[model samples]
Target: MKFAPSVGVKFHEDGSVRRFPGNTFICHVDPSLDLINELAWAQEQLKAMKCGFKFSYLPIESMHMTVFEGVCDQIRLAEKWTSNLALDVPLSETTDYFAKAVSNLGAHQGFEMVYDYVHNCQIGGSAIRIKPANEETKQALAHCREELRKATGISMPDFDDYHFHITLSYRVIELEEHEKAELKATTDRIAERISQSFGILKHRAVEFCTFDDMFEFKPMLTLA
Candidate 1:
């Protein structure tokens, strides 16, 4: 029998995950053929890892790079939620309010990003990191995020250190020491392969999407 942590907070050993309610702007990968190809390859590599730890993989079509995080039910702080809306406002209603709030912003200039790397999340998951392709792209994305901050009146605690990534899977159980090493080696290899294969992922627009869990994100509006 395997010995691993049984905390089971975000994900259960049986693979069921808790709901992570929120809405945010994301660069969905479905539109970019280049990204979609790289994504499929990366997913395959991750799934092929033979480490004993179980992983709950997300659907490929739902994969995306989050630009700016939005409100969540767990964090009810005023800074994390819109100022005008009540703290208890339903996530669906909050999503609607945010959609209209950002609808008027002029066409957001598109930007390009490149694969950075894949790493295990401190909490319990792994994601493929990404960054702007160039300085101009970085500046453009920063400007758009700033505009969103001003419009929504919600500022994340880690706004300064926000990491742009597309989540791949959540861990169903904590890994043993040897399994941790194995997982790291597997992720590093996948990162190297993806970096060599794909150059740039073209994002035409940012989509405002709401999510009930880590698996699916339903787009409510396209902010191009």
Candidate 2:
């Protein structure tokens, strides 16, 4: 079995998370029990796949949809990082600085996110795709992101083509053609069940969080 070289970019062969520190604004999935339970169930099913692929499932408590990405140690480009702050600024300091900079941005009145599909990222990960449920929700989400970009002074690379998603896991090994077929079949079933049962994910507050790795996001402050 040949492993994908890209898998080693973010994780060890044993599936341990590499150190990738950063901060961001996210809508956490933990506050809603129904949402959490549904996601946890889907995650378990993905873990149970017998196909010969290896991936690391993140802690359910850490599940979230990022509202606006913040500075990261790994990505030091001007387009992705905030201007006026050194690229080597401590993650904690950047988190603090952003908290105050956008403190007056006001709270989101909550929005409904409709299930889209399950996405298999080419870079070796799987995520549940989602979108705003209506035009109001759509505008709200976009406005928030735009406001954050202006307030934080960080221009996103994919600003125009950003897609909302809640990540499930990072693949640890490459999947063969046959394995991809099997994985897609299982994920399709899971996505169908989730869309039917819990189609709309009600996102309440936006949060500013710092993270030392992919598995955990430490909430520093709530934007809403």
Candidate 3:
């Protein structure tokens, strides 16, 4: 993991917003190389659509499993803070080197790298789903459901739970009938292949970590 300093507003489940100094790091486990190839194919499909906006795709290998945020008095201090933390380097040293290179650029510039990690991983698409019955898991899930109810002001049915997925591309906010049909067809073909690939592989856990301007990951007590 590599870390960088940042400043941003964080929205918590409690309905309060706070400003913080923070850093973000990427954690992945034996990510399938085929996934990168699939993303490239998706990017090509997106490019041909020419949805009329700057459509940038994140590199597949740089996906992040967690994002940390908190407040720092200044960017340099934050960077210095993160530099002192230890990291569990992934099997790919190239990714670690890239993380180091990006970190040296300072806080504001680092957000783009963070964005790339989140964007490529489709973290935003994750949806809430019911966990198997276990006291700890059940309690956590219940709390999350309560937060959603409060945030949306709607009492959603429990049976409606489903897996969450992140959006890979956003070309047109609203699409014409033909465009929607084309998109559906293309996505279905892509999804079929991805589903098969994932089905054959063992799943790994994704961790959540946060950092503050102090340039340290709160959970790991290290830079990355």
TM-score-wise, the better of 2 and 3 is 2
- Candidate 3 residue-wise lDDT, 30-97, digit = tens: 35645556555655665565331223333344333332121122333323232323233221332233
State candidate 3's TM-score: 0.36
Instruction: Go through the candidates in order and give the C-alpha RMSD of each one to the true structure.
Output: 2.7, 1.9, 15.3
Return whichever of 1 and 3 wins on TM-score: 1
User: What TM-scores do the predictions have?
Assistant: 0.88, 0.92, 0.36
Query: Considering summed lDDT, which 10 consecutive residues are worst modelled in model 1?
Result: 1-10
Which sequence of candidate numbers ranks them by TM-score, best first?
2, 1, 3
Worst lDDT window (10 residues) for model 3? 108-117
Give candidate 1 regions above 4 Å deviation.
1-10
Which whole-number lDDT from 0 to 100 does residue 135 have in model 3? 54
- Score each candidate by Cα lDDT: 0.78, 0.82, 0.33
